[model samples]
Target chain A: MIYFKKVLKKIISPYRIAGSLFSSQYALMLEYRAEIVLWAISGVLPLIMLGLWTGAEARVLAGITKEDITRYFISAFIVRQFTAVWVMVSFEEDHIEGKLSPFILQPIYPFWRYFFSHVAEQFTRIPFVLVIMIFLFIGFPQTFFIPSNKELIAAIIAIFSAFCVRFILHWTFAMVNFWTERASAIERVLMIPYLFLSGLVAPIETFPESVRAFALLTPYPYLLSFPAKILSGANVNLLQGFLCLFLWGSLFMFISFYAWRNGLKQYSSMGA
Target chain B: MAIITVKDLRKNFRVSVKRPGLSGSLKNFFNRKTILVEAVKGVTFKVSQGEMVGFIGPNGAGKTTTLKMLCGLVHPSGGELLVAGHKPQSRNTSFLKDITLVMGQKQQLIWDLPPLDSFYVNAAVYGLNKQEASKRIDELAAMLELNDELVRPVRKLSLGQRMKAELLAALLHRPSILFLDEPTLGLDVNAQSKVREFLSKYNKRYGATILLTSHYMADITSLCSRVLLIHQGSLFHDGSLDELTLKLSPYRAVRIELKEPQPKGLFVNYGQLEEFNGCLVRLLIPRETLTDSITSILNNFPVKDLEVCDPPVEELIGNLFKNPNY
Candidate 1:
């Protein structure tokens, strides 16, 4: 019990930092509520793809019913809404403007600030996502079915894990800003793979066998398809999905940490 | 004990050269050329605890670079440096807790949030409990003369108020060592004086060591007794401000209101006659012979009034930077 208490204390210590960061960031997000609405509205790619798929009458491909397509895309929209990552652009700006210096001087790792800000922004998007969901259901009441309690819990955990994985992946690339000024160009390059392979456009199962195999080998499908599949009530290997999430999270965490250490050596506090 | 020490500190940056036109751009893009620019070159100095030292230099003379190195914002290309018994580059948590840095051009507070909110966030990161953070905020707020300004969003506050709030945030942890880069940059005279007074009081009250860089000489002349002068990426002089003035400009401006107008020849051999209009006269007298010259003028001429003061330090330092031979 003593050992457990000590471990719990260690865990709770950072909760203070997280709490303060989240509250302030949430307050800041509220100030940019207009921009948040636009960002939330912009993430309707999954719904747009659903419309494209159904309008073409290809929604029943490979035993996927029309209702299944609607639910899948709707779930995918929610996943994308919550799992969006843009730390790269934000990090690049701070790194270039020398606004990162104060964070670096503090005792905590600076990534926590970005992480909490992302989470806070996600919280701020909750209402808009709900409002969009209302419009989505109004358009197709057939897709308004509620998820089961088990699926709801599982999807939440998986979606959050996916967000973490995506954040770390982008943060790893964001470290390239230390060496080059145009790191955002890499984000544009990443968009090609993310849009096509992450099931944001179509269900992974609809892809050809070889293509599905190749996409699964990358971390992109798990970032979107796996959680949306759970919410869509489709069959999925929960064990394998979670194991891949853990492995990819670990790999990117290690790589990002290494990049961060190396990047600090090259940081000269530009524009300071 | 020396809280900060340096030996042959150096930093170099490699900047790429770009060409203008399309053909030149294509050629450059195909085969880019780069040159290493030494921002700081073998600069060496030591700052002991409780000492407020001024670091002065021209725009590109590496003052900010040296401060960046000391605060671990940039790793040194070469040198031995120790701050509070830790290598700054290592950036140990303990070392971080022992120091704070403030850049006037940049701010740490969230722009949309009130400064008090940012202060709480910083407090939490620094491990201060709520009560402790509040008490410290109150104390610092009083010191900075900030009242309700803390509640206003940072963007809404005037530059001076925002900077005061920034200082409150930076000093919340009360680190023993401070590295301030242009802390008084872009502030009006009143704001600058207020900041200087607060810094002076803080240094005396807490005995905290400060290494500050500024374009405003008043910040240095009013606060720091010792000044470190850097020029062309090197430490040119490190001593008392008065000593620097004596070394750089050995002349004082002597203004006199004579009872009657005098000829320029009457003061030709005395010194460099700066002005001789009507009954008023001005001369730049050498420091060594200033006493004798003043006596001769007082005795020989019907001097109605005489006032003596050293030449402006900024003019001297500015001229020195403009021409190294100065």
Candidate 2:
């Protein structure tokens, strides 16, 4: 009777299942604290861009001042840390090494397992990223603007949504491993556009009008630059940002689902 | 009733042909060539409830592929398949709950964490309540003698210990059907026997249907009475082990020990000489002529002791594989 009750409870509450997955993965991530810190430190590209853009002659690019560039790049760095997704490497390894077989046999879908694990990793990374943010604020007191309570809530929501957008998009890309062994190579190709257009290197607004238009058309701007603009207290149309995120997130979700269904058909699970 | 059924199941893989040299590689990259390799070619079989069946085959004989197809890991290119009354390729959650598949080469446990942590994760995935999950884990861990090892990281445990933990993780939900692919591979004799004993006990206790594939004959000889022989993606024979032995091996071995030293030539007339020690002789005699030859040897020779037995199970299987007609 107790067993039947437990099964009944499980059928009703999938959030509990996700919560358990999140907890286990969170514990596992905590075991790799040094790696998390190293990864947080590795998002230094925006900081480098900050240095380059704030020079005396480079202060006013596209009607933006040195202080504005500093805030934009710093916010970009923080956003990048939150939105990072490395599930592609994990998927490629699991597929190549035959580690995916066991996951396939489980009653739960593998997508939720991977999703919770990545989310746990991001959760583990938050404190380390917070420390970096504090140091950056202490170093550049004049450039940073303390967001209002309303702005803070909006920024949190936007950043989290951006993380979802990035996660779903990359997860869709990772599904390419189902058909080809060179998925990491393809990821490297995808990273080029993400680096330039997502505001990891420079704010998309600094680019010319034509380039900015193209960047907005792609999903890359919604991932990091749009959220970074929100965190920097820049003027952003909330409705437009929400619309872009919802559309792109749903599109990527569909692609991932379709790829996963087709990939299972083609998956050989080659190695033991 | 059949718990698992497969009919004309087929799986073919498309493999790209690579050229030898750099220029050939360039040309081949531009104009690719692919060939269809059939891993499982119209194989068919049925496993009834509460039956422990051994699936034996040579390397590349599609044993693993067949197991994968039945477990819903790999989709069959053609044919109908069912497990626990559901089409395996459908991969319904209810079907998944009723079945479990364990591969010796693969693991479901998280490598960096303790097996207990993985157990909890699996418990949640399978929807077992905390109390029931702990109860199941404790019971299985005790049966597999994994009390002290469950808390250690999986990588810290030896292969045998880890394999035991893997089994516990797989069986936590008490699946009614199990698909085991080389579950005893790469274990020492003691560990192998322990695993076999645990599996035997688990099967008896739960009345689960097991279809196990293994290269080791001991695993089959001990746990499975019914054996399925597969070769070249075909089921050649399916019956009791005794039946297979009788049909495939038509000869028995006879040994004679003399009170005094015996000449090697003395046993030549009785049967084909297999071994000739100083005071003992061994011969291979046809099953039909076994009693006559034994009587003649007893009456003619100064035999102090005599014994007759069938050939080793490994030797019989080897011979069976060698001859495709059988």
Candidate 3:
């Protein structure tokens, strides 16, 4: 319990560490402003899908409305923005290049360091994302309705739970580096399903019924689409969505813990 | 009581030997040859508090393997090792607080950040409050002449300044014991001497026990009072540097500067000529014959200058490992 308390204190007092991490990341982002602008421009797939879905609703195919389309794609965009992580690339590079040993030697756990850095990255990217969102609101004034106060509350909850679910999943995959010499193969295989089923490119509503059923049972939808549904005010079953996200989060957390404990037994700290 | 102890410490590594050529590589994918290399074979040593010991070994001699085991970075396959009254393999916070490892080849500094920032990170990780950490940082910087360099990004600093920062980062916790592996691998003579001076002073001031391993014998000769020489996963010799020198190569050298170049091999009767320059020839004579050989060389050749010296630590240590009974 004392150890836990100490770890908590260090993590929560991020002013000592997180400030530098945020500043450094901000500096890096500023240095690459042109690249960031290019990335934001390329993330127009959601708007493209919005055009198709709104057209379908206008023609009365299954009675989809403009409000629902706005709510769905906007929620998808927000969820997609948060759940995506680059931890796999960082972990694979550190493992292959032998930078992992220094972390092993340090008194602090490596997991927490990665966690703080990821949070810092998210915090730094939020401003740029807000700028893009404001531009979208100005350009597409008639396309999507603004989120109400109640929908805003739901969006917050969904984003929180979505991050919890995705963080554990990425944590579990990062541990796979211990068993395999190279984990890039796992990254390649996981990306396809994650991008599709998680609703980063398109809402799960766009999938056929059979695929939608399978996506619901899997953990990927909770990571992006569920929160997106909430934020867009698409009238999701709030209790059911929370329970599904919670279950996947708990399961991934368990897998992450198990993998970390067992994989440590096999770790060699190569070339230390 | 021993501050650090090890009994039957053993570490084995399974390395896969991949075959070369297209067909052999294809065959290896289905079934590859794996070899078990006994990196450290049941080695044992102990150090009391405040004893600076040098760990010397050949390239594949398992010196680093043993060091990693001591630091808890790698778990031993078999052995009981304790550092600062704690099992290092457990990597307990208390144990980590009391010990530090400085690998000269690997640095802990953030490359893009100033050394001071890296020092601050270390301070946070070690649980040092800002005020206390600052005091120690200033002291270390002063001792290492890093006041000006600490503000510069570590990437811009020379290797020696960067190494000094690495040392300071390792010492911020004021660990009771330190493990230094190749602490002066790449440095100019002045930088190496400065590092040696700081290490010696730090050890003296703190009474911090150190077990330093290095390929450079000067690192051992200057900083380590006792030495442990290892070869091929076993202890070849463990005693004082002087004792090893005396036991392995009991010969003193007599260097003579002839008025002119002597015949190609005329000095065989005196002793074995170790080295020859234009006019200076160095001979290795048995310890008992040192006085007589110097006298004989002075009388025979037109010797302008002569001086007697002991064989270097490297030659003494090399011979000991090369010939076990030497």
Report model 1's TM-score to 2 decimal places.
0.95
Clashing pairs in 3: A71-A232, A75-A228
For candidate 1, write residues B159-207 as lDDT tens digits.
9998999999999999989899989888999999999999999999999
Screening candidate 1 with a backbone cut-off below 3 angstroms (N, C-alpha, C), the clashing residue pairs are none
Each prediction's DockQ against the real complex: 0.86, 0.75, 0.42
Q: Over the stretch A1-272, how does candidate 1's per-residue lDDT look in tens digits?
A: 99997787677769999999999999999999999999999998999888887755455557778888888899999999999999999998998888988999999999999999999999999999999999978987877889999999999999999999999999999999989966988999998999989999988988899999999999999999999999888888999999999999999999999999999999988977
Q: What is the RMSD of candidate 2? A: 2.5
Better of 2 and 3 by lDDT: 2
Tell me the tens digit of each residue's lDDT in model 3 across B233-275: 9876788888878777778878888899888478877778788
Q: What is the DockQ of candidate 1?
A: 0.86
lDDT of 3 by residue, A1-272 (tens): 99999998777655665554455545445555676656555556676777777767432554666777776776676666665566767877777666776777777777766665565555555776778788878888765477789988988888878876777778789889887867767777887888788776666766778998998888888777778887887778888889998888888888888887777666777655
Alpha-carbon RMSD, each predicted model? 2.2, 2.5, 3.9
Q: Best to worst by TM-score, what's the order?
A: 1, 2, 3
lDDT of 1 at B152: 88
Tell me the lDDT of model 1 at A166.
Answer: 92
User: Among these predicted structures, which one has the highest DockQ?
Assistant: 1
Best by TM-score: 1
TM-score of 2: 0.94
